[model samples]
Target: MEKNEKNEEEEADEEFEEDYEIKILHGYENNYYDISKPFFIYSKENLVNFEILDSILPMNTSKNEHKSGIIECRYQLSCFLRLTRDVTEVTNNLNIQQFKYILMTLKFLKAVENKNITKLLQVLIFNNFFYQKDYKLRNYNLHLIQILNSSFFTQIDFHLKKNIMSSFLNSLMIRYDFYDENLIIFKNSKELFDYSMFSEHIPYKNLMINNFDAFCSVENILRDSNVLIIFQILLKEINIKSLILNNFFRHLNPDENFAFLISKIEIFKAFTISNYKIPASPFFLFCLIVSINNNIEYLRLENISYCRLNLRGLLEGKKLKGLILSKIGLTENASLINESRNVYETIEYIDIQGVFLNHSIWHEIFQSTNSSKIILHFNNSDIEEIFINNLKKFEIQKNSVLYLEIKFNSNTLPRGFCNSLIHFKNLKTLKLDGYIIYEDTESLLYKAIYYMKELECLVLCQNCRNTKPYIFLLQNSKIDCLDIQSTSNNNDAIMIEFFRLHKSMTRISIKDAKVSSLCLKEIFKQKNLIHLCLDIDILPPQVDQESLTFKSKNIHNLDLCNNTLKYIEGVDILSKLYRVHTLRISKCNPPPGYLSKLNKKCNSYVKILTYEYGILDFDDLNRIGKLGNLLKLNLLGCKFSGCSFFDLVTSCKFFKSLKTINLLNSNIKMKDFQCMKRFKKLKRAVFSFTEFNLLTLKNSLASLQICKLKFHTMLEDSNYNEFCLYLNESNIYILRG
Candidate 1:
C-alpha cells in the first residue's frame, strides 16, 4: 500500500511537470481559433475606407450583352455622392464601368501594404490612367482580370482558363509578404475549378478542404493532377498553421502522406480530420500530433469509424488547448488499458459531440484539471453512469468551467448528472436541450441552477412545457437573456409569469411555442427587451388588437417567422415603436391595412424590412416607396406587377435611402426595371428567377448606380456560359457561392 501511494505521487508530479512544459510552450501570446463565431458576422469594418460594398445580399443577374464601355464623365456625380463636389473627374479615357472590381482585388491582397493601395481604387475610377495606361498599369489590369476569372469566371474549358490565370499568379508569387492565410479548397465544384486554375501559385497558411458533402469520387480526386500538385507543394513549402482534411485523406497512400505530414509536424498548430473510416490502428495521427516536436494546440476527430483509438495516451497529452471528439467509434471486440491519470491541465475547450466511451476513458478526461476558463460542450452525447457516480463519490469540483452545454440526443440523462452540475458554480452560460427529464430530476436541475450566481444566459429547449414553472425559479438569478422552445398548448400563463418575474430580460426568443393575448401583453410590458423572436402558432380567435399598443419602445429587431396565421392581429403596432427599425416577417398574411398604417404612423423610421412569401398590392408598394430611412427591401416570392412596383419606387420623391432591393421569384418586367436608374442610391439589385429582358437591362445599366447585380436563368448550357462571359466582359461583378 505504501509503494502504491508513492507510485501515484510520482505519476502526479510527472504529469505536473509535463503540464508546466506545455504551458510554457503555449505562453498566452496566441489565441485559439474560435469556431463558434457565426459566418454571417463578416468583418466588413476592416475595409471601410475602400469603396467596396462586399454585398452579401442574395441576388443574381443574367443578360446577353457583352460589350465593354468607358467610364462616362457624367457618372461622377452619381458614383461619388459620398465625396465632395470638388472631386476631380476622369477624362473619359478609361473604361471602368464598375469600380468594385478594383475594390475586390485590393481586398484580396490581404497582406499587401494598405497605404500603397489606399487611394488606388479612387484614382483608377476618377482618373485618366486607364486610357494612357503605362506598361506597369497594363500589367496590373491583366492581374486583376486573371483574379476575376479564377474567382468568379466559371465557364468551361478549365484547362484553357489556366493559361490566362498564370500571369496574375506569377506576379503574386513574387510578393512574399502577400500570402493567402485562409484557403478553402475542394469544398465544391466551383472551388475545385478555382483551385485547378490557381494550383501552380499555391501559397496558404491555414487550409480547409472538405470532401464529405462534395459530389466527388475519391478515385477521381486521387487521379486529379491539381490535387497532387497542391499536396506536393503543401509538403515542401507551406508552413501550415491549421489544416482540415475531410473524408478524402483516407484514400491516399497513408505511408507517404503520413510521412510527409510528420516531417512538417513541428509547424502545425491545429489539425482536424472528420467523417471517414480509418485503418486498424489510429495511433499514427495521435502520436504525430502529441509528439515532442509538435505543439499542436487544437485537435478534432469526428465521425471516425473502424478504429481503436488509444484514448489513454491521448488524454495524457498536455499540449492540446482544444479537443473535440464527435461520434467516434472503436473496432469490435477491441481491448485497451483500463487506466487513467490526471486530466489535461492545458485544455481550455473540450467539445464532445456524441461519443461512446467507458468509465476509464471518461475518468481520463474528468478526473482532474487545472484550467481556470474551460468551455465544455456536451452536445448530443452520453456519459458513463459510473463516471457520474465517481464524480459524486470523490467529491470532485469543476468550478473552472465558464460555459457549459448539456444537449442530449434522444437519450435519458445518467442517474446523477443534474445533481452533480451544482459543482460548476462559475458557469456564465448554460444550454440544456433535448433531454427527457422527470419531475424529480427537473427539481434537482432547478436546485443546481439556483447556485449559478454568474449565469447570465439560459437556453432551454425540447420538453419545455414540463420545464416551464421551474424556469421562473431563475427570476431570482440575474440572467438577462432567455430562450425557450417546444412549449405546448396553454403556455400563456407560464410565459406571463416568467415575463412578470424577469422584467429585466433584454433578448428573448420563444420558438416552436404558442402564446396568447395575455402572454403577449405581458411580453410587451418589458421595457428592457431589445431583440424579440417569436415563431409561434396561430393566435387565439379573440385577441384585443386595440389593447396591443407599443409599450416596449426600445425593441430594435423583431422577427416573426414561420407563423401560420393569416392575419397577425396586433402586428401593426410595429409602426408605433420608436426604436424598432428592423422587421422580418415571413410566411404570414398581414392584417387589413398593415403598410397603410405604417405609412401613416411612422413611414420614415423603419430602416430595414423584409416580407417574404406573401402578396403585396399596389397601395403596399406605394407605401413601401415612401419609407424615408428604408435601406434594404427584400420582397422574396411576393407576387406583384413588377412594372408598377418599379414605377412607384422610382417616382417617389420623399425616399432615396434604399441601397439594396431583392425581388427574387417575383414577376418582373426588365423593361420597366430600367426605371431603377432614377434611384441614385441603389448599390445592389437582385431580380433572379424573374423575366430577363436583355435589351432593357443594358439600356438601364448606363445610368444606374448599382455596383453588384444578381441574376440567373434556366437557360441552355451553351447560353449560360455566354451569359457568364458577357457579364465578365461588361465589368459587372458576379458573386459565386
Candidate 2:
C-alpha cells in the first residue's frame, strides 16, 4: 500500500511539473532598475503574471515566500472584497489585469511587512538605486517636506500616523548621517525627530521616544554602514549562492557588525572580487579568507593589485572546486605553485587569463591536478613548450578534461600546441580564440577534434586564417554546434565548400566572413540546424539555376545582420526561412515589397519580428499587420519619417496578440502616439529618443494602461518640461537617458 501511494504521488508531481513554468522577460534595451522598462514575470498556471518594477529585485523562489506573497494576497483581498459573502464570486469578477495589479501591490506589501520602509529607503539611497530617479523629483528633500506638511497627513489612522512618523524620522537620520554629510537641507531636516512632533498622538508617545533614543545610540554605526547594510540584508534574507564584490573596499573598513555577520553565516558557494586597487594588509586578507567556511566551491579574482601572495590563502581549505583568475598581478609565482599542488587534486575547473606565469609553475600545477572531470580555460597566459610537451607526454588531462578554451593575445598558437590538443580525448567543448591557424595547424586542430569522441561544441573566433578546417571534421566528428568568426577577408568560397560538405550542425553562427548567395544556399541545406546567425555581407547572387529552398524545419531563430540585398534573390532566400519563429534583420537594405513577401510566407509562422536601421514605408507597415501571430515588433532606429505614424497604427489593426513594441530612435510623431491605444493587449512600449508633444502625451496618459512606458531622451528640449509634467501627473517617473 505504501508503494502504491508513492507511485500515485509521483504521477501527480509529474503532471504538475509539466504544466508549471515561470519565465522572466527583459526589456528591449534597458537596464534592470529602469521603471519605464521593468522585467515581466509570466506564469499561466499560478495566476502570477505581473511586472516587477525593479528588475534586479530578488525573485521569490522559495515556496513559503511565494505562497505568502501571492496566495495570501488573493486570500486577504478576497476576504476584504466579499460583498455577497462568496469569495468565488468576488474573484470571478476580477479580470487578469486586476489580478496583475493585486499581485504587484501585494509583493510590495510583503516586502514592507517585515522590513521597515525607512530602512529600505536608506538602503536604496546608499546603494545608489534611486540616484537616477531622485533628480526627477526636483529637490526630493523639499518635495518630501511639502508632502509631509500637506493636509493628507491628517487623514490617516492614528496608529498609521505614528508608524509613518517613526519611519520618516529614521529615514531622515540615515540620509543625514551617511548619504551626504555636507548637505545643509538634510542637516536641517534632522531636527524633526523631537517629542513635540508626536505629542498629538499620545497613545504611542513613549514608544516613539524610546525608538528615537535607540536610533540615537546607533548613529555612529549607521554612518559607516555605507553598502555593508545592503549586503547584510541580502545575506540574512536570501540564500545567495554567489557573492560578487566588484570595485569594493576602496578605503572603507568593515565594521564589527559585518565581521560578526560574516562569521555567523555560511560562506557562499562562489565568491568573486574584481578590479580592486587598494592594497590590503596581509593579516586582514588572511582573516577574511579564514572566515569563509568549507562550503566554498569557487573563488574568482580579477584585475586585483593588492596582496597577490596573501590571496594564496584562498586555496588553503582544499575544498574549492573551481579557481578563476583573470588579469591578476602576481608578485611571487613560486608560492602559488605550492598552494595549487595542495588544492589542485580536488579542483574541477581552472580558468587563468592574462596572468604572467612561468613555464615551470604552469607545468607543476598542470601535472599535479588529478580531478576526475576538469575544465581548463587559459587566455593570453604563458604556456611555453615545456607545458605543451608535458601535456603530450603525460596525458594526465586526456581522459579528465571535458571543456578546454585556449585563447592567445596574438593570433598565433605556441609551437606544437595544436598537436597537443589531441590529448584531451574527453573534451566535450573546445574554444580557440585569437588564433590564426595555418592550413597545417588547422589540419592538426581538426585532427585533434577527430580524436575527441565526446566533442559536441566547437567555437573558433577571431581567426584570420583563410582555410576550410571544418572540412576535415565533417565526416570524422559529430559536432552539433559550430561557431566561427573570421577576421580575414574573402572566405566565402571556403565557407561554401565546408557548408556543402557538412549537414549535421544543429547550430551555426559565422560572423565577419562575407558569403555570397551560393554559400547561404548550401547552409540552408542542413536539415538539423535549429539556429542560424550570419553577420556577414551577403553579396549579390551568383548565376545559378538550382532552386534555393530551405531544408531545415527545426530552425526557430534566424538572425541575419549587415546584409545588403542588391537583388531579389536574397529576399527570396529569407522568404524560404518561413519556419523560423523569431527573425531579426538589422542594418539590411531590403528591396521593395520585402515585407509583403515575408507576410505571405511567414504570416502564421513568425511570432517575434525585429527590423532595425531600415526603411519601412506605409505599404510595408500594412503588410506587417497581416502577420497575425506576431507577439513582439521591434523597429529600433528604422527611418519612418516619410511614413505617417497614424496610418501605420490604423493599418496594423490586427495586433491582437502583440504585447511589446519598441520604436526607439525612430521618427515617430507625437499626436499619433494616442492611436496605439487601439492595441488593447499591448503591455510595454518604448519611445525613447523620440519627440513627444504634451497634448498627445496627456491623451496617452489617460487612455493607455501601459504597464511599462519609456519616453526617455526626447528629441525636442523645448517640450521637455511639459512632457515631464504630464508624465509626473500620471505617476510614471522611471525615466533614464
Q: Which candidate is the best by TM-score?
A: 2
TM-score of each: 0.51, 0.53
- Tens-place lDDT digits, model 1, residues 1-737: 00001232233323121211100111122234342652222233443232322221111122442122111221221233222122343233443333322332333322133332323334443243222342123323443343333423332123222222222222222111112334444432212211221121122245555553331332233343333333333332334566555654444344533332322335556666666564644564554435533466766677776655655555554466677777776443233234334336566676666566666545555555444343334443335344445656542347877777666554555548777787888878888877677666766777778788888888877653564355544344677787878765645676677777778888888888767777776776777888888887645665565676446666778777786243245445555566667878777766433555553444666778898876677767777776777777888777763335665565474345677788777666665577777766676777753565555666676665566778655544654566567667666666631
For candidate 1, the TM-score is 0.51
Query: Roughly what TM-score does model 2 have, to 2 decimal places?
Result: 0.53
lDDT of 2 by residue, 183-225 (tens): 1112222122222322111111111111222322333333434
Worst 10 residues of 2 by lDDT: 177-186
Worst 10 residues of 1 by lDDT: 17-26
Backbone clash pairs for candidate 1 read 59-710, 60-710, 60-711, 61-710, 61-711
